[model samples]
Target: MCDTCGCQLHEHHHHDPKVVEVNQSLLAANVQQAMSNRQHIEKMGAVAINLISSPGSGKTTLLERTIEAMRDTVRIGVIEGDIETERDAERIRAKGVPAVQLTTGGACHLDAPLVHGGLHVLEHFAKGAGYDLIFIENVGNLVCPATFDLGEHIRVVLLSVPEGSDKPAKYPATFKGADLVLLTKVDLLPYFDFSMEEVRKEAGLLKPDLELMALSATSGEGFDAWLSFLDRRLNR
Candidate 1:
């Protein structure tokens, strides 16, 4: 597949090199659509968040808990991204909020243009219950998702305890661009060799001003701080 827009990569017809000397990121098109999508989300009376993490890092589980905790007080909408299947989307819908599944069809990331289509579909599902917050659950990959802009007001990176504290250093590009870092499954801290101090320090080295939150979605550990952070962003 083509790297830029996920279209099929193929040879182009020979053309005069002198006629074009374009300088652009392979993600140029995605960046443009991301800017437009940001404006569109703002116009929809909602704040958007892009969640990224490795597979099995608990992104969907966190969303499920978040919906259960705030659905009555906060109008929430979700866009689930995966290589295939709407099962994640179905889980969100059971909570009675607008949810749309965006199958990447084998892409490793969710870029801006794909999200634009998701927003329209979500609004249709919203019916009369408009959203105050929109969460875009990106395909569970810590690498490629960091390279594409997806028009989110906040970008959160999650690191589960079982994944160890070295993730920030190992995936610097992803953690470096994060607005917040979430350490999930912390209730299992006693069973894991994870070092919170190292995780914080490494993430700080990459993104000095990045906010950090530690929580266990299952046990509700440190959830108040996470909820408060979202509250602040929405009120902003």
Candidate 2:
């Protein structure tokens, strides 16, 4: 019975709920765009990587460093996502690599459609220069971003040491969806309360085969593994 007006279930009543059986995931639109985006990325001669993490996880900084590290050996491009501003893309462009920024206005996550547009923009910037790998740095978010697929071959989730180690257990869905979990800002371990063991244990419980690495982008600690991982993915 409808508590507001007490309308009968079978009668022609406004209070009766429609109960439309639209058995569809909230990410349906995103999934469709992802399928198309994957094809688009392949056509552009590159594999894409979607990086997710909470605010201040050093995603942009890491990308800046990554461009310096791999731009010469591997043709790298980037699509930066943010609520507003093209600062990240500007930073990437300074590295002499083509980059495009997709500002979401107020969206918390970067969906596949936005990335699809960004890919085209990047192509325009490059104008047939080509890229071996495209990094779609997602909006700084650990929750809603996990639900949407940007057609990336690998989804990397970053966790800075200052954010602590309890994030995996706190946000299992994000951790489980990750193909690789990068623990950043590890150089600050002595000052922070982060526990490496706990983070790995929780993340492992969620995804038994989840690849993980601990490093600091600032200190250049544990970066070779990340570069190797990227090489393997691109070659594959």
Candidate 3:
């Protein structure tokens, strides 16, 4: 039901004027909602981090380790986004932190409006105590999630060692938008053919001043810097 082409295909190769207008409108609304979300997060006395990565990139594992390491010091809350399953939220809950699972049903990304609801739920879980850090674990897709902001103060994009070093070059939009690029699963570096130098160069090309860190959540390798980074963000 395209208003321009009169064709049923809404996502055709040609740039339909109506489709472009609709997309722009949608993004505009999302941007407004995202700004509101940021204000809400600040009001809750929390700094939000949006974690974006492909599936199996160890985002949840990183959160698990992070929560275990700093839960006593930091008031942590999580909003888990996925196409289905509350498993991630349950895992965070086991670590004894408040987590809200937002199932998109089939959507590949979590938008600000959805996260706004999650923030309220997370606040209710706090019982007016509020949080020091809020983690929005975005749906595991490198592409769509990059285009939407969930009201996060910082956006972290994780690229596991096994995913290969060419990912930064392959997905420039995702890497370019990252505030921090985490090279996770460095413990498996020896097993994979991943090149650290290549990742550094490619990601540097995408974002010259991008902060990159390598860490193994399983082996606790290069984790101190990651924790320190969070500490600075929370303190600032």
Candidate 4:
């Protein structure tokens, strides 16, 4: 069984010395592949963003809204990672954006090699025109996703209003690795007991310089700042 997620693949067992060595080897391989993937994305004329969050944290919704808001100005593509489903990729395609779905079977997170494959498919779908922005919507899990870098230029972690403010404290490693932390579903704030101040404090403690934004994809509240952030990244 895998120590990290208890899957039958045994890809991440670390209790025994042999397993530890194997894990290390696997991570090293992933790192090398991730570096190559970065170069591949650059060659395709695109910057990739890895989006990480727990299930139901509004990651997909944010992407759909982002595509709707910027599809005209930005040549956006998506690589959707999920345990099992073409559903999210279908959603992105419905928005008139090219999307590649990568199902990890039962794995909790996406590794670099998987994303490397997805990038190729995305590029093929682009038909040599290339892309300005590529979003890798990672499998819906915060813990495992943090350990594997998928060659993204920016890592954004989402916390919805209903997910509570304590998520940062609970998932410190994920937040620490994030370049930006988004508080999604802000329109639900009036109905939920979530605290923006607490989220800011805990997330700030984990990442002192983290760029934080609160936005609602449904209501369009605080959504412009999110778009502006993407614009700035594309311009940079």
Candidate 5:
């Protein structure tokens, strides 16, 4: 059981066959929608990326900076997910990119069905210009978002320095689902007790070959690598 949330994270025996069947059915439906979402994105000539992390992990700031850096060279679209408010989408719009905000109405995560609608809105925003990349910023929770695929080509999880280095081990499931991990707020390293070595070691235990990068979006320190990572994916 998770000490913080009281949620079961490991396998356990369930005698209720109906409950098991229902859960399986729900997940299967989600998978089908996710596959369709992937096809839709491909048809739009774009690759989608899902970003998952806890609140205050600098996901929006990272997107803001990334849009500023890549806007001229890449046709980008954003889908910002939150439990409430269109604030994040407005921020992206301020940067002049097509952004759709999906408010989950108190839900903890954004599911494939929810993102499907957002994708359509984003497509409308493109007006047939087409996009090179689509960024889906999942609701700011590590746990629930990990269960939904959202049809992304890559999944990037963020861990800010202020959040502590122990997060990777503490939230093993989220880290394990990541294709790449970003250690944000690196500029605060000297101020916080966060250890880069500990983060790398623990995350490696979850995913041995997981690509990791440390950057301070505020400072632009190590930011170039992030742009290159996106460029490589877009080119591929």
Candidate 6:
């Protein structure tokens, strides 16, 4: 079978088995760490929310508004994930809450082990006051973050109005994995061609019973419902 400096060989040796095994082992380790992280969160007397979305979806802006609306009543903490800068964590810290920034270097996603470290840092900031809620803002990506669990009590996915309503259908894996979906930046809905009807229809097709909420961080529109949702979760 010598055609272009190719020698006769069997197909069984074409694939490397070690690579598959390594990947499986890595995932297994991540799952184990995630379970442990959940226990760690409960021990801190807090319920964690893992937030996933694309860049420019106003995740930080939403958090800023939320902290302002709730800081007086709810004990809050934040863990901001990003590829490089500590800018988001700084923003949250300015709001008078404990925030930890975990830079991924060049990775697209934040794994459970990385979050485990962030949780420890947050605990130090708690100073035994005990937190009511912990928000883990995952790096802005619709895909890779869905595959990893940060030991969060709930997973929230955000889709901004300008991003188009077709996102759910295009990125089914992310939408399908969400415990709750937030359609943000509704203030610009009139300017953009994004249809709320299409978003609901397509997202429903993927997750029939998925809880959905629409809000604009800038305008404070629909934000009361969002705060109420968080209140209910904390009460539970």
Supply the TM-score for candidate 6.
0.89
> Between which residue pairs do clashes occur in model 1?
none
Once fitted onto the true fold, the runs of candidate 1 whose alpha carbons sit more than 4 angstroms away are 1-21
Please report, in order, the local distance difference test score of every candidate based on alpha carbons: 0.92, 0.90, 0.95, 0.93, 0.94, 0.93
Q: Which candidate wins on TM-score?
A: 1
TM-score of each: 0.90, 0.89, 0.89, 0.89, 0.89, 0.89
Give the 10-residue window scoring lowest on summed lDDT in candidate 6. 11-20
RMSD values, in order shown = 7.5, 4.8, 6.8, 8.8, 10.1, 5.7
For model 6, residues 71-139, the per-residue Cα lDDT tens digits are 999999999999999999999999999999999998999999999999999999988887889999999
Single out the weakest 10-residue window by summed lDDT for candidate 4.
14-23
lDDT, model 4, position 39? 95
lDDT tens string, model 2, 12-87? 4564466688989877998899999998888878989999999899999999888899988888889999999989
Candidate 5 error regions (>4 Å): 1-26
* Pairs that collide, model 5: none
> Which of the numbered candidates is closest to the native, going by highest lDDT?
3
The stretch of ten residues in a row with the least summed lDDT in candidate 5 is 13-22
Q: What TM-score does candidate 4 reach?
A: 0.89
Give me the runs in candidate 2 sitting further than 4 Å from their true place: 1-24
Q: What is the Å distance of residue 65 in model 4 from its true position?
A: 0.8
Output the TM-score of candidate 3.
0.89
Q: Write the per-residue lDDT of candidate 5 for residues 72-150, one digit (tens) a residue.
A: 9899999999999999999999999999999999999988999999999999999889899999999999788999999
| Residue-by-residue lDDT tens digits, candidate 4, 70-92 | 99989999999999989999999
